[model samples]
Target chain A: MRRFATLALALLALGAGPRSGFETMTPELQAMQRDDFANPGMLWVAEGEALFQRQGCTGCHTPAQMVGVAARYPVFDAGRDGPIDLAGRIAQCREQRQGAAPLPTESPEALALAAYVANQSRGLPLAPDPDPRLDPARRQGEALFRERRGQLNLSCAQCHDDNAGRRLAGSAIPEGHANGYPLYRLEWQGLGSLRRRLRSCMVGVRSEPFPPDAPEYLALEAYLAMRARGLVVETPAIRP
Target chain B: MRAACAALLLWAAPVLAQPAAFQVVGDTIPASLTGTPGDAARGRAIVTTRQRGLCLLCHSGPFPEEPFQGDLAPSLAGAGARLTKGQLRLRLVDGRRLNPATLMPAYYSTEGLVRVGRAWQGRTVLSAEEIEDVVAFLVTLQE
Candidate 1:
């Protein structure tokens, strides 16, 4: 009986906290993520760097100036009146500064730019802006994360929070951190944004996914950034 | 007195039967799922196919033909000896009542959900007949 109690307590402790998806990956996958040449996600980062030059973004801001910029995204934008992620910010820059039409969300160019920008902040700890003004959106995101929905009657927390490290259909359930975006997934065989991954989760749970730039997604991103407070960025990550 | 009690229980069975919809009672479902007996063959097809039940996404079972099987949920190798038919029905109907945070999708029941896709609104993952079919197949797993 005493042994059983101790085991139960240990299990409870494991279930109570958050963990990086990196920790859950196999050694080979970890090595793949660590090596820039071998990581499939690097293809997108390379394309994004090229796109950045072609778009004339380098004329004003050098790559060095953009480094660590992604660590502070999903920040409150007064003009947009909500939190905007790096993808949204890239779209904003295209329209406002470059006098170019905003690229469609998840378009190759948008994904590339987002990937390039995120890669700049690679290795830096995620530190989304903590302004008090963004609290309401963050709270909404928290609620969305916990709210049960879809035909499954499940919340994101159901798997990511309670079942992190547990297997789900042969895939390990990570703590649902957004430290990686513009990540390359083996399942997708290409790069995808945070919203794209979120939409996939929604569909997996048989729920309706919001549009790419929906406020709900932004709120969710804000919440994820806050949740993954200290985790290092893993842009262009490889995952099964 | 014992005979009278037995008679009363039989007489009250139908009256107590929850109308079509499932009614969860604690950890076990105290009632049988359907009026008709389940067909194991039909149940097997539903459980194995991705278009219908998609049970293989999170469950591994005795089906050797299917190439990929999940290890997320417990294997259904000896499920017959493990749980009663009524209990299986409860899990199929709404597993949330058993473990509120379970990832198993409710094959039936449509209530208190949000952001449901337009194409799937008001539709349970599996129909009542399909639920019975799957349950029938699961109850046959003795190995």
Candidate 2:
């Protein structure tokens, strides 16, 4: 009987195309995401704009120049032998170009910059760099997504794929897309990185998570970007 | 050897279920860990509690008071009608023996688990008596 239910849900998933987590949120949340002034993440965007001027970023490039950069990220970095997301690129630029220290993951400064940069790309479609080099990392990310781990022995695909629209208690499981990240999660009551979100999930299943900035996270983000291709960016997206 | 250990422990130890200390035979354990029975009332509390059993996180049961119940796996509404007491016992102990890809956790075993949260390490999700109590309550869930 359980097999039959799984099979039915699988069939239902087949009929549904890739959907965003935004579509799963309540009406109140949707309204909050729609109104820029009401969205708490805009606060970070404002802070980041100030930091850009104070840190001399505005001297090198205007705010308009950074537009759409977030849409084509998790790029293959030949030097690192891995992919680097938009947030990583920011830190790299600060270190290599600006001669500054690296920002810790999900630090207030890091999230602020990520929100500011990503905010520019809002409404732009995710177009992951299709470099031939990224193929290996993308495949690795795909494998990791399907592989079962933790004491629960559940894979990411099991819930996100098989039961995309089903309720896991009170909340509906979104398709696990990566379009709206660096967004505010009410549960966290603050902004967070996608890696932070993924780690929470790993721990949720009683699994050990990779260290911060692990290649596995880069690979997964790259894979998710590829998977969520054409989906419009919703940086600083509000989530429940 | 395992059976001898089970026999020796049944006589020597007061607490029968000692965290991954039960022996398996075929698809079932075939005997109660305590050599007696468990409290169904206590078992119901464990199943309903969010922090302990976490059963409602995936399996909805006959509890009407709990407004939030998961639909991830099969419903436990008629678990007693669907599975025997021994079958249910095996599942609560570790469903991986039946299906390696199962999302269900081994409520009583701690071996082979990687990166268990610090607070949850070195202990089972439930004690032997708790398992028996849960089993007792489930068997009563004939509907």
Candidate 3:
């Protein structure tokens, strides 16, 4: 019975869910995220709103139509044979539906447009669909998250899971959830995507980063979205 | 004939003293490398700097003068007394071999890594000399 109790306790520890990075921010940074007018990320949302109409997205979908849509992204697209995030979906619409060229990943327009779309879902809980097809991708992402690589020999779990809230260098380590992506980072001084952040983390570990739309990144995105399923979307949020 | 033999022995002495390439035996490295001795002062410089070894980023030490020492990993205040030189060398070479999930970077290895930037590919995080230097410095932290 003692052995059984120990096993149960270990399982409980393993199941502990992740926390939002917002909780780890300084009070001043939290305040920056609260006030939309003062938030620099709002600038990208505003730019994205303009792009929505100029790019003819307004013809089929208004801002209200996009509400709560961002919360269900990184869904498996059978046509594409894999998962695609909101950013990829936007690029697809531009190419297939609007007849416009696909926006380059990480471009200002891409950041702005994604920010705008993500903004419509602000305050909604992330609810990625549990498509069975996504299970394989999710598994792969879980593997990637735990796999140690790079010169540092560190996995995402090493910092975000096992040592969350610990300090690395001078900065406090967060759980690394993707709830508030396309966030305005004080360091970047501009809007950035979750993929951009992931790329930076890859570089931090001295690992080569996969390209913007690589399957590995997509897989990682799929897992992050699933991991933050219950967290409220805080799109265009501020981060230090 | 005796004088010639003495001269030959003298010439071979320095070459024989050269440090051999590192070899891992299980988790611990053998103590005493065969190369030029490391400078503790140079090792201290590497540990404290962010652009180099950046050891202070995770591991704290007795350097009260350094304002931003981190507190993530174990403190290095008395590492010299706690671990032998061979153990320190192994940790610096590839810590993951000892604990498969260590967050410490392999300061002097170039294998089984992914996505290494173009400018840094095929290069270890630290040269063998740097590793020896760091080991020398770490072994001095007796208190």
User: Which prediction has the highest DockQ against the true structure?
Assistant: 2
Q: Any runs in candidate 1 off by more than 4 Å, and if so which?
A: A1-18, B1-34, B60-74, B96-102
Candidate 3 residues B40-142, lDDT tens each? 9999988877557767668788887776656779999999999888899999888878876677887666777766655466777777777778889999999
What is candidate 2's lDDT per residue for B36-132, written digit by digit as tens?
7888899898788755667877789899998777788899988989988888999998888888777788877777776655445566667788889
Report the lDDT tens digits of candidate 3 across residue range A1-240. 243245346646889544788988889989889899888898999999999999999889988999999999888898988898899999999999989877878899998999999999999999987787987788788789988866566788888877878877667778888988899877777888998888777766766778655799888888888777778899888877
Candidate 3 Cα errors over 4 Å, as ranges: A1-16, B1-20, B24-27
Q: Tell the DockQ for candidate 3.
A: 0.25
Clashes of each: 0, 0, 6
**Lowest summed lDDT window (length 10), candidate 3 chain A:** A1-10
lDDT of model 1 at position A80: 72
Candidate 1 vs candidate 3, TM-score winner: 3
Badly placed stretches (over 4 Å) of model 2 are: A1-15, B1-18, B111-114
- DockQ, candidate no. 1: 0.27
Which prediction has more favorable DockQ, 1 or 2? 2
Q: What is the lDDT, from 0 to 100, of the residue B130 in candidate 2?
A: 85
Residue range A141-204, candidate 1, lDDT tens digits:
8888988887556788877876677655445678888888888877677888888778777776
lDDT string, candidate 2, A1-240, tens digits: 243245446656878546889997889999999899999989998998888888888878888988888889988887787788888888888999999988886789988988898888999999889787988888888888877766555678887877778866656778888988898988788888899888877767656788885789988898888777778899889888
At residue A170, candidate 1 shows an lDDT of 47
lDDT of each: 0.76, 0.79, 0.78
